[model samples]
Target: MDSQNSMRWLNVIANIGVLIGLLSVLFQMKQDQELLRVTLTNDYYTSYITADTSFAGESLPAIWEKALLDPKNLSLKEMRIMESQTFAPINRWINLYRLSEAGIVNESFWKSQVNLDAGYYLGDSYGRAYWEVSKEDWDDGFLPKELRDHIDKTLLNRKLNETLAYY
Candidate 1:
């Protein structure tokens, strides 16, 4: 009887240990998920800053201003520069849209990004003109239908000469 009691107690202790082990693993996994989210957010900001500064110390700004005022009058080289500059933001938007769709990015953050993109890309005259010419190039499998629809809806509502306010 003593041996049986001892064995029963040992089994209960073993079961408790197993339960504690499983709980530890779950806690660790949650921590790892949160860490991943933080890492991705950091990487996103780093990439954005890099893109924003890519045209610094160059003549692109003057060309950009000229294009913004009169896109049709730009030379071939100026048009190419405009296209290259536009690509950076477009690529960022596509990446953010994909991340948002994958649940890696929060909806509110994604919506804010979309709003900013709409203000710059759909509201400005040169941006709208660029989209009219370049959108067809993105009709390949790379651009998702849902994102395209979202952009088109934003474009429909924006004015051609609208500008983004800093405040």
Candidate 2:
């Protein structure tokens, strides 16, 4: 072939090689994302199992139940137990929040989990009290914003109702 034809063929080959390289990088990125998602999901399940067993296998559940029923009557030790009970699920929430923020978890899944746990956690007066006290200990943006806003509204509503009840 002439030198001009040879140079044209080389240019086409270089473009094809660049395209192949780009496709390979895209495939690798997709694979990495899938792996990250699976890892996050597995971590979430492990956390859930730990929390489930901790609540079921020992006296922790009973203690927490009693405190939830009569939060005002708890001794210091019982209060501390309640605090730890509260932290268990909240820690899961923080992990899930991190996963969601990183795009490892989808928005719908994260919202469902948050809503489910909030129903259980916010149902108890002691849970609400613990949230109020411990919230400051968490980093400002660590928890999901919607979850924090819901708790803020719930606490405000409780305070308002209490004030009105005094009249």
Candidate 3:
């Protein structure tokens, strides 16, 4: 082949190599992003599980049972026990909110979990009293707006559907 034709063919192969390199870098970046998402989700999941299992560690079930029956009737020690139980889950929620703010966790998933938990925990009068007391301990900006709103809605529903006390 003439020198001109040979040079043109070499240039084409070099361009193809550059394109391949760019594509591979893009692929690597996508994989890295996915791995980061999974790692963040796993961290949040571990925190959630720890918060739930903390009840066993703190011996909260008996106290929680009593508090549920009549929060107004709890002694100072029992109130403290309830307060301690409240903090673990709230701390996990704070961590989750931070992760959501950092864009490390999925906002929609966090929102759903927040709503679900609010429905379960704030479904009655005792939980509302516990929250009123325990919430004073949290720093400003710890709970996200979505979670706060969910709690508000749950409490409102509970008030609207008030049932006679069986205590």
Candidate 4:
């Protein structure tokens, strides 16, 4: 009878140990997720800074302004530069969107980012022109359908005559 009692106590202790081990693993996973979020946020800002530095040349700003104002007048080389410059931020937004969809990044943060940049990058005339030119390429199964739909909705909702005062 005493041995039966000892076995029951041992079983209870073993179950508690297993429960504690699982909780510890869950706690560690949560910490890792938080660390990943911090690292990704830092990387996003770093990439934004790097993209801005690409326009540091003296002639580039004028070219960009020209691209924004009169895209039709730009030479092929200027058009390519404008396309590359414009795509950088759009690509970052796409990645952030994917991360948000995956639950890796908070949806609120992603929404804030899109709210801040989508108007300038997708709503403005230059942005619209870029999209009109490049959107066919995006339909080749590389971009997710939901993101494409979201971009389309943003374009449809944006004011065509919207202008940035600072530019």
Best by TM-score: 4
Candidate 4 clash pair list? none
**Tens digits of per-residue lDDT for model 4, 21-132:** 9999999999998898889988998988898787657867887778667767888877777777778777887788777877789877766676677667666566777877
State which candidate has the highest lDDT. 4
**What clash count does candidate 1 reach?**
0
lDDT-superior candidate, 2 or 4: 4
Count of steric clashes across candidates, in order: 0, 0, 0, 0
Candidate 2 residue-wise lDDT, 1-167, digit = tens? 69999999999999999999999999999999999899878888798787667655466767766765677888887787667667877777677767777888886676566666654655477777788777876666777666576556555544322322434
lDDT of 1 at 93: 69
lDDT sort, best first: 4, 1, 2, 3
Q: All candidates' lDDT scores? A: 0.73, 0.71, 0.67, 0.76
Given candidate 4, what's the lDDT at residue 112? 68
Q: Provide the global lDDT of candidate 1 against the true structure.
A: 0.73
Evaluation by TM-score, superior candidate among 2 and 3: 2
Model 2: worst 10 consecutive residues (lDDT sum): 157-166
